[model samples]
Target: MRRDAWWVPQIGAFVVLSSFLAYATWAAFQNAHYEFGSYLSPFYSPLITGDSPHAWFRTRPWFVPAISPALLILPFPAGFRFTCYYYRGTYYKAFWADPPGCAVGEPRNSYLGEKSFPLILQNVHRYFMYAAVLFLGILALDAYRGYWFAGPDGVKHFGIGVGSLVLTINVCLLSGYTLGCHSLRHLVGGYLDRLSGRPLRRKAYDCVSCLNRGHMNWAWFSLFWVAFSDIYVRMCSMGIWHDVRIL
Candidate 1:
């Protein structure tokens, strides 16, 4: 009813996040040109089915030639985000208008916590964190591959390119978001009643706690950077732009 500063950010987040979801969904189904030279789009990382010996899986249903390889793997990361604690608060307000913001009137008078059919699924966030960690490892490997390139002389050389740095930054930001997850923090040492006696676990808990303090910031940063990394690689693969060599 009343205009406020919070509404501006809510609307902005809704627009940006919706646009990204649309683009990512479209890009995932294309299943073409996800890799260019040393750069690989984050959206298509861990390429399951492709024309490479290193491919771990290949889809050959013959019924769907246009089926994208990423279609099979995107659900893991998508699930993690969909049920993320930070994201729950985000979309709950932005999209669902669950009391949109402080002092704002809610559309529903009766609030049903995540106990019903669909919302009860939110309880699976911890399990999704496990898969998210695995994906971080896979993406980190992709970033490492970005630093290696073959020369015209049929020799491999280690070098850095603009795409390499972009992918590296994307992985780092994602790692921050994943490692800082509340579930991870609880896993680290939340069960221990006396953390004072365990030095190693205490240190680990402190580290994760530090990151958790900035969880929201990491969430948005990683979200945008991953999308940017994918776009950068896509453009390079299409020959629309060239990756600048840094080394």
Candidate 2:
């Protein structure tokens, strides 16, 4: 087969996404420095174990001291991303070589589609969306927490730091991606046979449709920012760098 421009992007996507997966896996297991001051890594937000402030609430019976809190929460978001409509198409072509691109030939002679065992699990994307929505709430709360810091005088004050801004932007981007999900759009208004009669639902559908148009952009933006937010918090927590105060 003749090579084309598509290969360039396909290769780039594979490299970048694979690198992220490796880093996330390593970070999740480390389970340290996920929270620094008010900044918390998105990967480990809503922490349920280890050094989490809420650890006294009764840790998971299966929780191990050596394991990272991120191990408990990363699955939901990971599942959502793995089965996302856009991501399915992306990794299929880039990583699986399931047609690679427009004219690229695939090695397999036949396709099983999503009816098979593992692929059939992709059908659970809608359910994952529900969990994803809940996670958005948790991340938003973390971002809110980022805005309050304690002073040397032991007085809590409303202030902003570079990490605070980073966490805030991460939540916003993640919200955009989660809200713009195809399953969410369908849930909002896709079932209606006559949207004209329901102005409210119609309006909601329109809003989601607008967001859906940029789903791919939101996907990449959220992916990078989430990792960046985690790295920023980790650096600050490790005392390798200091969070710059903005307010």
Candidate 3:
């Protein structure tokens, strides 16, 4: 009775997620071409230690292994997404076929839900939400910095470029996703029983709820844009694509 190609969405999720994972892994291993002028890849934002002008530290320790700076930062966002409530159900259905489609039968008899090992690990999502919020601030700064470029005399001045807009849009999308996190919603207002008593908490919770309603949309769009942001910076750095300054 319910045979209307319900598996299409699951298959789409599998392919997009799998392909993004592969591309992100490959891009993270390439240490170079992650920066061009003032444009920095979201994957390598808050540049810890490197030769780039954006690096927080001037030098890398000789004892440290040669690895992409992205590895140091990617874990936080990756963890947040991996433990995401939406993603958990997505992969469970799409990849594991726990219930391939609506009205479909489960492969196993017992349903442990998040009570099981790997799924239980998602309990840490609240902690990752904290990290994700902090990252929003950092990425917002990166976007602001994107609007300023070095002048010919080696001085920085206000300017706008394709990269700047790219970074800005990425930050907006990321904010939508990170702010809408279920854990954050609970932290902000879930603890209280009466929102009418606390105006501040009520407002905060309302804002978060607005975005939470579209969590799945925010997640997918942000995922795609962040990857595209990295690609844009990398291409510009490699001279394969040009960063056209508008200001």
* TM-score per candidate, chains pooled: 0.93, 0.93, 0.96
Give stretches of model 3 more than 4 Å off.
61-66
Best by lDDT: 3
Q: Between candidates 1 and 2, which one is better according to lDDT?
A: 2
Highest TM-score model number: 3
Instruction: Report the poorest 10 consecutive residues by lDDT, candidate 2.
Output: 54-63
Clashing pairs in 2: none
User: Using lDDT as the measure, what is the rank order of every candidate, best first?
Assistant: 3, 2, 1
TM-score of candidate 3 relative to the true fold: 0.96
Q: Which tens-of-lDDT digit does each residue in 16-71 have in candidate 3? A: 99988998988988888998898889999889887788898877777645678888
Query: What are the Cα lDDT values of the candidates?
Result: 0.86, 0.88, 0.91
What CA RMSD would you report for each candidate?
2.4, 1.9, 1.5
